[model samples]
Target: MTTTTTWALARVLRDRDASLYLAGVVVSGFGTSALWLASGVWVKDLTGSDGLAALCMLAMWAPTLAGPFLGTLTDRTRRKPLLIGTNLLLAALLLTLFTVDSPDRLWLLFAVLFVYGAAGVVHDAAESALVAGAVPAPLLGDFNGLRMTATEGMKLLAPLAGAGLYAAYGGASVALLDAVTFVVATGLYACLRVRESRPEPRAGGRRKQTAEGARFLWAHPGLRPLVLAGGTTMLFAGLSGAMVYAVIDGLGRAPAYAGVLYAVQGAGSVVIGLASGPALRRLGERRFAAYGIALTAAAAGLRAIPSDPVALVCSAAIGAGLPCVLIAALTAVQRETPDALLGRTAATANSLVFTPNVVGLAAGAALVELLDVRLVSAVIGLAWLVTAVPLFQNPASASRTATRSPSDANPA
Candidate 1:
């Protein structure tokens, strides 16, 4: 890492509030990661229906569609309190999973996951707004990068632990573990100390305020492309995801191969997260994101190959490339938006960027059944390559730069 990146990370660790914020992230992220895998497995084990198991993922993701509207809650309240309350609420909800012992109670599981997804949208919006206040501007990139690292790192370790627990006890055991983590995360959020003035109510009605975030993002010169790039990359990522089973089969491996691929991808993401800050400083957000997309495009093509080693390498490449786009986009939003609008802007951007992935996942899942997997991978790679063309044509050098001063960026 560059000295700037190193120092920025060190500063985040030294600051008490920032440290507490990151601690909450680590604990909650571990629980979320474990639950992500365990939910699908749990549903599958109960019903033995692939479609129903897939619906679990849809349930978790569907609430992001309302992210922009829900995010306005952060703008309406003090973020720290909102963060703590959301965590506690999620913990209480997870406890309800303990009652879901049979297939007949699966409806409860889906309902809880759907609510969990909505709470996640609110929680993420609150956290993003809070971080802009808690950490210095120069350190935002490093803080976000480290946050990504912590989450992805948990992805590497937590699934194994969740699976083991689920195997030995049951899905309810996994849910209990997740609930305990959320309780701990709630305490961590409560410990954070940051100065947040009450937000001034806007003159316009709730409708106008709800739309403000999306309007602002669309109007920004520098941020618009970065956000769009995120959406485009995710669209293709969904396409690639649909081919996971086919890719493993092509490599003459069992279904367990997918787990190995995921672990390798997580390892790659950890390295990329560490390096993203320096990369952003050197390339700026637009070009950095473009480069990451290009890498993802190449990885998509490589994944079309049937070789097992190549498949592993391609998975790692995908992991490394995807996070750069997300982190760069998020850091840019943090650096550019005013604190009062940060929550709404971040949530709106997130919804726009990620909702496509969910749509693509559904679309790709259907498309894969009809099309040849290798051909689908190749076409998806080509589409990502085409998406990068506009990004390359308009580099950050030619665009409006992000606000450099912390006070200017977050005038509260």
Candidate 2:
């Protein structure tokens, strides 16, 4: 790495609050990734049913559907204290997993997992808002990029560790591992030095409070394109992802070969995430996300050619490109929204961007049954290209238009 690049990344780590926040994220991410994989395995082992195992993931993800609602809690309180309290609560809740010794007790496990997921949504919203308040605005892009790197990096290794620990000590051990991380994260959260003010209660009823987040996101011209492109990209990505086995079959490779493709894709994401800070500055969010989508689209189309080497390259490109819209959209959300509405706005934006991924997955599974993999790949690529076209404004112009002062924010 160049000295300049190294110093840029090190700056987040060297700062007091950023480093503590990043450390908390890294610690908890390892535990979260590990437990998610282990939960599925635990159920699979007890019930000997693939469907039951799959439901474990569904249990965790289902709570995100209520994300905008959950986000309002953060806006109504001081985020740092809320962050600390949620961590402690989850730490205690994870301990309840010890009771899941038999198939019959799976309900308890699912209940805890559901709560765990809800907590995650709240934690994420609070963290996003807190980071915006704590980190220097100039460094927000770098901070967010490094956050993705920490998360993606944990995904690469934590599952292996979870699987090993599960094999050695069983499900309860995995739960304990997660619980301990939360406690450590709680401590880290306590050490953060950001000052927070209690937000005044909104005049509306509870339901209206939640709707405000969605309204703000839709009305903002600058954020609308990035978030829409993000959602669209994820949808295409999901469709393309569902065809992984077919892509392998076409190449005459075993299904196990898919791991190699995923690993390369993940590495590509890691590399892109490391450079994303500077890339966002140079290309600006609009062109950055547009080009990333274009790269992803091109790679998806190329995967239909069925060469192993080409598949690897395409996988890396896909992984690298997918995060661009996500990062851009999130950074823009932090920069544009007023603090009073930030938590809900961030949550609403996430729901819009990521929920389509689930829809695309379901649709792609059905499409794969009816269409050729090559045809499916082409359709997704074309759709991605369509999404990118509108987002391809001049970076210089986009930067000027989008870098709005906070005082310009619309009142809720």
Candidate 3:
């Protein structure tokens, strides 16, 4: 690591609030990843239907559609206690899943999973709003990158553990494991030491207030481009994500080979996350995101080459490149939005960014059937390339961000 990024990461690690936040990410992320995989497995075991098994992910992700409304709740509430309470509430909800011993109780599982997704939306919005105040502004990049690393690392380890526990015990054991993690995360969140000052909610009905967040995002020239690019990138990513099996098929490899590709991709994410702070400091936000998207564009086009090594490289490149816009968009949202509107803005940005990913996945699934894999990849790559071009333009707002002192650009 560069001396600058090393120190930046060290600062993030040393700050009490940042450390607590990272710990919460690790603990909660692990449980969520574990439960995500195990729930699908549990469903597959019970119903013996691949379609039903796939619905577990859809169940968890569906509530993101309601993210703006959920986020408004965060804006009006004191975030720390609300965060703690949500974790505790989710824990209690997971405990109730102990009664889910048969396929007949599957409705209960789906319901809990749906609520779990909603909690995630609120928790994320609250965290973005809280962290802006808690962590120093310059270190936000380092903090966010580290958060991404911790999350991706959990994805690597948690699923195997969840699967093992599920095999040895049952689905209930996985729920218990997730519940315990939430309890631990609640304690971690309680331990964060930061002065949170939320501005009073503007006087308006809920609908108008919610609309305000969306309006601010669309109206901010700097934020609007980044958010739109983020959404566009995710849309292409979803299309490519659904092509994994097709990629494997092209390589004449079994479906299991995709797991190896994913692992490499996750490792790439972990590594790039460590460097993102320095990159963002040096490149400025828009350039950093633009470059990452460019790298992803190259990776997408190359994935059609049909070589195993090439595929692995493409996977890692995509992993490393994809987080740029997401972290950039999210960190920008937290930095630029006023604290009063922050929760709603962050959630709305997320909805804008990720909802397209779901759409892309659905679309890619259909597109892959009708077109050749190479052509699809080439088109997707071209699409990402188009998405990236606008971000490189010099905007008035970006000039302001670029002029901060080195200390402000880096970390404290």
Top candidate by TM-score: 3
Runs of candidate 3 exceeding 4 Å displacement? 197-201, 397-412
- Candidate 1: stretches off by over 4 Å: 1-5, 395-412
Please write out the lDDT profile of model 3 over residues 190-289, one tens digit for every residue.
9888666655656768887777678777767678889999999999999999999999999999999988999999998998899888888898789999
lDDT values for all models: 0.85, 0.88, 0.90
lDDT of 1 by residue, 1-412 (tens): 6787677678778988878888888898888888888999999998999999989889989999998899889999899888888888888889999998889999999999999999999999999988887888877777888899999999888888899999998998999989999999888887777877888977677777767787677667677888999998898888788789988888999998888998898888988888887788788888888888999899997788999889989999999999988998899888888787888899999998999997788788898899888888988898888887777765444233343322223211
Q: Which structure among the candidates has the greatest lDDT?
A: 3
Clashes of each: 0, 0, 0
In candidate 3, which residue pairs clash?
Answer: none
Measured on C-alpha atoms, candidate 2 has an lDDT of 0.88
Give the CA lDDT, 0 to 100, for residue 5 in model 3.
84
**Model 3: how far residue 175 lies from native, Å:** 0.4
Query: TM-score-based ranking, best first?
Result: 3, 2, 1
Error of 2 at 211 (Å): 1.4
Screening candidate 1 with a backbone cut-off below 3 angstroms (N, C-alpha, C), the clashing residue pairs are none
Descending-lDDT candidate ranking? 3, 2, 1
